[model samples]
Target: MLDDETPVLDNHLHLDPDNHRGIDAVRDFARLGGTHLLVVNKPSWHLGVEAETGEDFRAVFERTIEIVDEASSELDGRAWPVLGVHPGLITRLVDDRGFSPDEARDLMQAGIDVAAEYVESGEALALKSGRPHYEVDDDVWAASNAVMRRAFERGAELDCAVQLHAEASEDMTEVTDWAEEAGLPSDRVVKHYASGRLEGPIPSVMSEKDRLETAAERGEPFLMETDYIDDPDRPGAVLGPKTVPRRVRWLLENGRDEAVRIAHVETPERVYGIDTEATLERA
Candidate 1:
């Protein structure tokens, strides 16, 4: 069983109130001992925002903030907003909106700039950006990388973490270089949906039983996440919201307290610079 002293944080998650379980899913997490969530913005298209201008992304970012606020109140947990453009949206801009590769990249950078404004104003904690996860031509790939670099620059400026959504691989040295080039520390960049194969950037590993066990055994620092999509049609697609806390509970029950503390307590404090346990105590 999870003790109240321990804090369980989901490093990356999404909640769409109009179309999914939303706060109800958060309640499930809190019930299972989750105490903090880094709620990220979904792609603009998911929110029905056709971004002809970069400012159009405000709708998605604002909605994400609203959802986080609601989750904070509805559950016995804390929720922080992480706003940014999803790299896959580049394809949507090209195919659906007929944007050229360069134009799409520029618009995505502008979107990251707008998200940075939220972080500047303290409405959000971090910015998210990354290249396309799927295969693409050289030109598209280059443009995607440029957009990700822009996100890194903004994160560096704001002194906040940047959650990345990029290709899955062990060697993230290339992405780490981009972040360092932009003056953001490599450790401040979080690799979402990670499989523990990472260099430089911090890994927000999916909370699978074996994966968690391996991560604990290695004793390297990492954050845990469910990456819950919160889509009704694809219910529990990536992972369910209750996963992190339940997994943490199991780990705790199995004498993995030190790893749990590193993941839930130390890593988040170092990466995001927020003391969730302190927040919980104040509550």
Candidate 2:
């Protein structure tokens, strides 16, 4: 309570055992006023460019659920899992394993289906799927878009929100179009790491202070993310989740209560479905 009175919800975090950032990172985040965390289970790594078996992916997801419980118990903050098939794996499979385009797409769908199953069973809250390492190759675009569309479709079928980790150039209009085609509303698809292109139809998480000011000026409501890599070597590769609350508190200190209320409280509760009152007991 010493940090800030306003309860904060971090919509994206990584407490993966594989990353192994250690519990101190979670404690540090809580100590700094992070109340709730959406712990996105890391997908396969781009470093080891190997094809992943469906069983291997499922095991990783199951471990993700376990880590969510562990983080919530060990840290004062509430933790939830965002399950998905990271698109980079598809690229690796095609590029390293010599998987044909169809094989890669099919493998991605299998992983997505598993994630959808977890969502339906209440093992995870939302979906996190994105196409990364995109290039001018029309085949890559075709495959990536198809994978993202399928992710949206799965989310729609399960009535869960979908968060994308796609290209920075991908705008809300394009995402909304895909979501509509997949039978989901625009607001349910959150464009993570959103920058530059603001004022989109869907909700997104931003980090820049000036852009945050711009969003406030336009009366645009969105969430904030640090993309917290939890890597000691990278040392806040994206940022530490604590950064969001610091920014929000600065705004609150400066008479930006309305903006803070909308972004931190209302928007997170509405979009990420977190109960702010029940979290960050350690903070």
Candidate 3:
């Protein structure tokens, strides 16, 4: 029997149309024991380098909304959706349009406004790909922060949480500072991909043990994620159906369990927004 007090939340997951297992596969995963699954919507055009375009960007956002609408009713509160303009796409949009920094910021803000409505309806707002472009020095960084600020202001009113993808320790710190400045509760903000940096050409890695240890020392409660199985064909990407239990075991072995929270299993309740009663029945 499962312990009543054991906590499990799949802090990161991708449920786009391209998922090999399809939505039903994710649903089955959640039925096992996933408490919460944070789902992200990515633009189809941005899925690969070839399909990227301004029209495709908008199409992706629209499709993401459609997907959420379909899944949310079935999943209920079990699935939390985070909507945002990915940094990589933002860079591409800027480069493609030849827009000045100010123009780019305005465009991104517009995207956030549209995304906020979805969040206001109970979906969480997630700012994915924070490091590659939204750093202090980059022009897009300020724009990205502005987008976050808008979402934060709206989310605060609704008691919603905003999820952020942190690529580097510095990026994590920057995001934390921004959240603090906005007077947003730290607990309301969840950072994704907390595992230590992995050695490779890919941008994201498991966060270093020391980094997580330090966060724990400071009494910060952040979410830890293992975004395993990046498509080698598509560089700079991460897909789902994570090795949850195995990753959790690794953390326990390293004595990092107390430093982070792990969701060992993902069920439909967590991944697809299924109803609790239904989730329990499935479990």
Best by TM-score: 1
Position 24, candidate 3: lDDT: 57
What is the full ranking by TM-score, best candidate first? 1, 2, 3
**What is candidate 2's TM-score against the reference?**
0.89
Which tens-of-lDDT digit does each residue in 42-89 have in candidate 2? Answer: 765621324355545677688778878877775555778898888777
Runs of candidate 3 with Cα error greater than 4 angstroms are 1-7, 18-20, 24-28, 31-35, 47-62, 65-77, 123-138, 170-174, 196-220, 228-232, 235-240, 249-282
What's the TM-score of each model vs. the native? 0.97, 0.89, 0.65
Q: lDDT of candidate 3?
A: 0.48
Q: Write the per-residue lDDT of candidate 1 for residues 1-283, one digit (tens) a residue.
A: 3676888899999999789889899889988778899999988898899898899999899989999999988555589999999999989888788899999999999999999999999999999999888998888899999999999999999999999998887779888898998999998999999885467788899999877887788788899999999987789599999899889889888999999999988999888899887878423
Better candidate number, 1 or 2, judged by lDDT: 1
Which stretches of model 2 miss by more than 4 angstroms? 1-5, 46-51, 74-77, 196-201, 278-283
Residue 117 error, candidate 2, Å? 1.2
Backbone clash total for model 2 is 0
Residue 84 displacement (Å), model 1? 0.1
After aligning candidate 2 to the native by TM-score, how far in Å is the CA of 219 from where it should be?
A: 2.1
Q: After best superposition, candidate 3 residue 140: deviation in angstroms?
A: 3.6
lDDT string for model 3 (122-220, tens) is: 544443334342444566666656666665565455555565554444335555556556665544555555543322111122434454454445433
- Please give the RMSD to the true structure for each candidate, in Å: 1.3, 2.5, 6.7
Question: Which of 1 and 3 is the better model by lDDT?
Answer: 1
